[model samples]
Target chain A: MTRKAFITESDVRALAADLIAAGTRVVAPGRVGTPLGERIEYRVANKVDEILLGQDEPARSLKDFFLPPTDVILAWQEKKDQVELTPVSSTFAPQVIIGAKPCDAAALEIVDKVMDWDYHDELWFGRRAATTIITLACEGGDRSCFCTAVGLEPSGTRGSDVLLTPAAGGYSAEILTDKGEKLVAAHAVRFGADKGADEARAFAEKGRKRVDANLGLKPAEVRKWLAGHFDDAFWKSIALACHGCGACASVCPTCHCFDIVDECEGLGCGVRRRNWDTCQTAKFTMHGSGHNPRADQSSRMRQRVMHKFCIYPERFGEILCTGCGRCARVCPGGMDILEVVSKVNEMACGGAK
Target chain B: MAETKILAFVCNWCSYGGADNAGGMRLKYPADVRLVRVMCSGRIDPVFIIKAFERGADGVIVSGCHPGDCHYTAGNYHARRRFAVFRELMIFMGIDPRRVTFSWVSASEGGKWRDVVSETVERVRALGPFEGYRGLTGRQHG
Candidate 1:
């Protein structure tokens, strides 16, 4: 069993302050100013007070920390006769993330399966090893939140080193890994007896009940229906409103496609970078010979769903989605992924709709 | 410093013939421009232009027959409509749309081809090399 202890709100702040004072980078959820309005986002925290741990969902997830929007993988310099290649460093400095959402934290582990599948990504695993994730038990965002439906709970501890549950007086922190134990052991004075154990259980129970009402489906059954319905007309109708903007993939934690480009800095000197790419774009599937396998938005949209609910699970033994529902929440076309998933569940249970 | 590099995609029926006519007339233009002959302007996809920039072309030009003079009847018309949307997408992707130029050139317009090459080379030379795209490589992470 994992070790449990209580950390008062003030002690948590002191611990963060200590980390910052020691020159360690700390990232947490905080308000960010955008052109539209203020939204909560995970940003580098300069002070302890900037840390916001609550039920509010950040506009973005934690994937960017590990897999950046763009990064240089290598650089090339052409000589008179030969070319020299310089590989980018894969090592990263140690850091800590506080108050991460359970859905966002679990996403890293889910994506880890592929990063280590055929070719192990040194950069991704380098950052993963250099950082310790402290996840805050969620209240599960609005009805769009469906972690429970995807075999995760509001207080799930899949990818977290330490799981913190909100309770009366303070938070009950469960040390699940050696990293978490090291953190608590160094700041032993900041931890105490687990006084909020009962209240933490109640808080988790209430959160589960609230999220359970969002969507109910069997993952295996949904995958079966999706695998069999590759050419169904339902895909065409479901994608009628979609414009293939790819905003869903931008916000989705598990959509990990990337495009590599070699851009020249000057004559004969250039860098090869891998930038974030999505399957929703026409160019993503466009062949050099002017042939496009996915010629329409319908096929593209179906590919997104199929990859998440069917293909990944069939290969990885788990679903690709944490059911964060950011895809449904940010879609400009008003397309709902969960609604499509619920339809799949219905068809798998009874008959095709 | 090296001279600016500009890539031009020209139609086999019109713009390519215009370039050949310029060569036959012995007209002097900037040697920085490189020509790529295509069956029609409509055959050029936006990805080709993007790929050109990725491969170190500082600027790009697409020249074909006038709208009504297309050999396939509507190849230039399709190219016009596609480029209108593609320019906007380039802007959204943080690329300066000014780096791309679209023009009409008839097979007999050799003087016009020389003027187009001169102007495009001058404009792109002022804009300098596309260092903005190169800078994007290591920008997103710490």
Candidate 2:
């Protein structure tokens, strides 16, 4: 038998307090005072008023919580015979990330393959392992959402421990995994049996249909077309307007390219840092001896497209794009990925010869 | 005319072999093209390309295997895709995309190797020295 419960609006605050009292760090969206009124911010849940569960999505991504813009990876001191490398603390407290959308959770899974394969990244994995994600199905889809195109439903539970669907004046919580079950059991009294799970499911289906209508391409077909058209002129034509500002790459849920650098001062003490990098930048692939293989805009654009649709799937059996539509929204030139993928497919069918 | 400095990135499998073939035939191409061999064309990072221009290279040429003829099977394909995008980005930054060239050169194509070097040298000569990046970085031209 599966356990299901309804968490009413009034009980949300108490439930948040319970999670905090249980020694788990709870992160949820809140409003922070900025120069221009209050801006949505992710904050540690100390009070129930700090949690915002009904919003479409945060203005910024949840990636900053795991991979900060700048982190001290190493600290070293010069010694007589050898360099003394100070070990950074690996201790991380378990955390609960509430109100993540299904597409955001799915994006983490896509990132996990790149961060885990060949070289296991402890920084990213440690944070991921310590976090249990609770995803909320969008009652109404936003224009910037297209999760359905990338093999995700608005209500999909691909990367969540628990999935919550909106119900009449309450939320129907489904324990998707053992971890979620344990979490619910810790605060069982606050939740009651939800007999309206069937109705919530119907509401979620209606939301998924709106998402599907916005996504213009099926991911599998896009991947197939990209695999074959390695030398098409379509890349140059579409990518000509790209400024290489890296806004699209930075906002994208699955763009995970990074660069490692060692920094030092006059004292010979230094730290090695890994920072987010984008192929959209011209300096991403230059060699030490003054040679560059990827020295063109069309080539760089093709790389971004192929990395998302072709190479990633061939390596991980999953596409790197979650179709969060953040890239399209953030690109200065309005470089819509859906339009690019559509053109790729059209060319594959001999329409753009 | 002063000799133009050109950086040639030769992929380990094909273009490097093509360079060797040029040497074996004693085919006199411009000595201006300096060769830097890499494991695969795909492994060539775009940062190095920008660095070459910063260091006062008149031009840069990236030669790999004919699309599907890479020793690593699909290395050139990856290179092609990457370079196409990087080239566009450079152009948007006001760097002439012609300063960077991508061509499919096979190991047996010694004549093609000569042609690539001569053509790149002539083109860079017409463009004069690469002075745009030097002004921004405040570095002396070579």
Candidate 3:
């Protein structure tokens, strides 16, 4: 059975302070001053006061912590006629991520399927093994959030070691893993006896109801339509507004394609790095002979939706997206992924079909 | 000052010939530019420009035939439309669009090619190397 505890607001703060004092890396959602304005962002907490839990959504997801936007895979140097290679280490320092959104947390687990599928991604799995995630049951996210529609609840605990739900004067912490149990045991003084289960349940239900009103779609039906409709007219006109800027992929927690490039600093020595890449661009499918398979923005846009809903599910047994809606919110051309997927669902499962 | 590297994508029948003429005339132009000949300006995708930046080019130049003088009819016209949109994307991604120069140079205009080269090299030198894109490569975080 999962252990339950009532962690008061003061205790939460104290725990963060203790973790920081002990030289542990603690990440939390905090107010970040950006050129755009003060936005919530996940960052390594320097002070306990900087840790903000359960309010506005962070501008970016927790995926960046595990799988960074850019990483050096290896470095090569010229030695006479033969080239020498130096491989980067995959081991990482232990860290704890607090206040992860359920959708963002679940995305890691869903992507875990592919990361370990064909070849074991040592870099990806290295960070995963070293970190623990504590998810805050979401109470805020605008109309863009639709976690419930994608089989994830606002208080879902899929990839989280501990799930904290808001309650009266505290949070109801459900310790779901050995990591979570050990954390609570180490800080036993900071927790009280379980007393807010009812309040947490009520809070979770309210969050679910609010998110459900934003959008709804049958994912399986949408996947079926995407699998069969390779030449659907809906795709040809779907991305007229898309600039193929790939801003959506930058923000998407699950869009994990990367481009490997060798950057030579001098004549014979350089680093081979992998930077975040997206399919929305023409070059993603371009051949060396200059033939592009997905020549236009519309076809590229189709690939994004099809891969998320159909290809990933057929291969991994679960949908790639967690309905985080960052793709919709970040798209410069106002391309709403939820709306596009809903249209597919309507075409496949609505009364017309 | 460190020498800036400028990658130029030139059309085979027009800008390539123009570059050859400039070399033949010994017109004084910056040696910063490394010319890559393509079949047509239309063949240059924005990804090529992006990849150029990723590969350590301080700046890039795309020189094709004069609007109506493309060896393949309407090649430069297609290139023009693509560059216009690509410029906006470059700006959005925090890259200065000025780092990329788009110009027309027919085979007959050897002096014009020299001028384009000198002007682009001077402009890119002022902006300096693209460290912002370089920062995106290599290990950023753990």
Q: What DockQ does every candidate get?
A: 0.16, 0.01, 0.19
**TM-score, chain B, each candidate:** 0.91, 0.93, 0.95
Docking class of 3: incorrect
By lDDT, the candidates rank as: 1, 3, 2
Q: Give lDDT tens digits, candidate 3, residues A237-346.
A: 88999999898888888888999988776468888888899999999989999999999988999899988999999999888888888888888888898888878888
Quantify how close model 1 is to the true structure by its C-alpha RMSD in Å: 6.1
Off by over 4 Å in 3: B1-141
Q: Order the numbered candidates by TM-score, best leading.
A: 1, 3, 2
Candidate 1 has a TM-score of: 0.75
What DockQ was computed for model 2? 0.01
Specify the highest-DockQ model's number: 3
Model 1, range A50-154, lDDT digits (tens) per residue?
Answer: 888777988888998988888888889999989999988888878889999999999999999999999999989999988889889997678888899999888
Q: Where does model 1 exceed 4 Å of error? A: B1-141
Interface RMSD of structure candidate 3 (Å): 3.3
Ranking by DockQ: 3, 1, 2
iRMS of each prediction in angstroms? Answer: 3.8, 16.1, 3.3
Position A95, candidate 3: lDDT: 86
| Top-scoring candidate (lDDT) | 1
